[model samples]
Target: MADKEMRAVYAETLTELASKDDRIVVLEADLMRATGTGPFKEKYPDRAVNVGVAEANMLSIAGGMSTEGYIPFAATFGCFATRRAFDQFFLSCAYAGLNVKLVGTDPGVSAAFNGGTHMPFEDLGLVRMVPGIDIVEPSDPVSLKALVQQIAARPNSAYIRLHRKALSPLYPETATFEVGKAKVLRSGTGVTLAALGGLMVHNAVTAAELLAADGISAEVIDVLSLKPLDAETILASARKTGLVISIENHQAHNGLGSAVAELFAEAADRPARLVRMGIQDQFGEVGTEAWLLEKFGLRAEDIAAAVKKALKG
Candidate 1:
């Protein structure tokens, strides 16, 4: 199990990265504690910035900082990160080709009690439409640390869909991760269970095990990089399994599921069947994470059932 909470890993990783590169700066919409960047702020008081509750102003500040050769990682709630500051991020950062790491913490149901207004079910779709923005959702502490360092080192704009809580370690301490690639955790032939985010990927693996008990083979792929969907890896799995089901902690319309759909759509004569399991285009509600996941049919058992239903077709 990962001993450190994800926010600790995030802050520790940023502190490590900043120690070597003076260009790395931390920006928050007065969410240093919420996003776990308080340690980073403490370590480098001059380097960490707080823009109060103004997410848009934070992005604009980050954009300006990017122009001055400073790499800024702006952190805020997912809802405010996308819908609240969409234009500033789209134009001030991405459009201007600035290198700002915009961190959207507590994506989807991870917002839990924060409720619908705080939940960002369409964050990926918004960032996906941006021309050259990089998207990554790390599933565990190991991957989160590795990806955050990689994201901070990049010279182009990127969005880090962060889930700020602790979970059992999903990858080995020696695991190597790369941007724009999906990591395969299990292999099977009956169907492909594709997922991203911490909760979804962990459930996908459990769902695979459940499928195996029923004499069905399920392959699990962690679609960590939402943008640049790893077509090579996912396509091969879909081709072998002949069915694909993508699960996410987001809206079914335009998140990872939609990305896979577009990929399959472009593949032409490739594998055909796809089942997207997620929030059915509804507003997020105030609930426990478990309740929200079950309410939206995103639990491991739900995933297993969806696989069975799709296979029956």
Candidate 2:
């Protein structure tokens, strides 16, 4: 079981980075408390700015600050961070070629009790539409910490879909990661499960174990980077298994599923059949993460059954 809260790790990473790089700034839309940045603010008051629920203005502020060579990490709920402040992010930051790291917390069903209005099932897809912007989702505390540093070190504007709650540690402290690469968690010969974010990636691993009992091998790939897609890693798994199921906590369209589909669609010799598993077409409702997982058929059993059904066909 995992014990670390992602938000704590995020805050710690930013604070540590700020210690070495004085140019680092943390911007929040009145969500510093919710997103767990209190420690950072306490340690570096001058570098922490709260825009008071104005997400759009937050990004715009971040955009302007980036021009002064400050590396801004603007954060808010996923819904507002991407949908409401998208124009400022796309135009003021990405279009202007300024470096800003936009963080969207509690992505997808992770919003839980916050309900539909605050939830974001399309944040990554929305950011995907912005040209030259990098999109990433970290699967655990380790990845979150690493990717935050990696994105900060890069020049391109980036969107980070973060799961703010507790997630089990999947990678060791010494684990290394590349910005635009996929991590293969399990190797198998039967089917491939390529997943993004903390929730889906863990479920995919469990589903792989369940498949093992039935004499079926399932490979699991943690899709850390969404925009770059890590085509080679995914395509290699597809070729090895001949079937690829993309699992995510977001909408089925234009998220992990669509990314994988595009890979097979454009491959010189496509080697796999693809199935996209996620929220099909509906708004999220108020429910616990476990209940919402079953409601949306995103549970580990659901993934295992989906694989069994596909194999039977």
Compared with the true structure, all predictions reach lDDT values of 0.91, 0.93
* Deviation from native of the Cα of residue 257 in model 2, angstroms: 0.7
- The C-alpha TM-scores of every prediction are 0.98, 0.99
lDDT (10s digit) by residue, model 1, range 190-284: 99999989999999999999999999999999999997789999999999999999999889978888989988999878675899988898999
* Model 1 regions more than 4 Å off: 1-3
TM-score of candidate 1 against the unseen true structure? 0.98
Error of 2 at 162 (Å): 0.7
In terms of lDDT, the poorest run of 10 residues in model 2 is 1-10
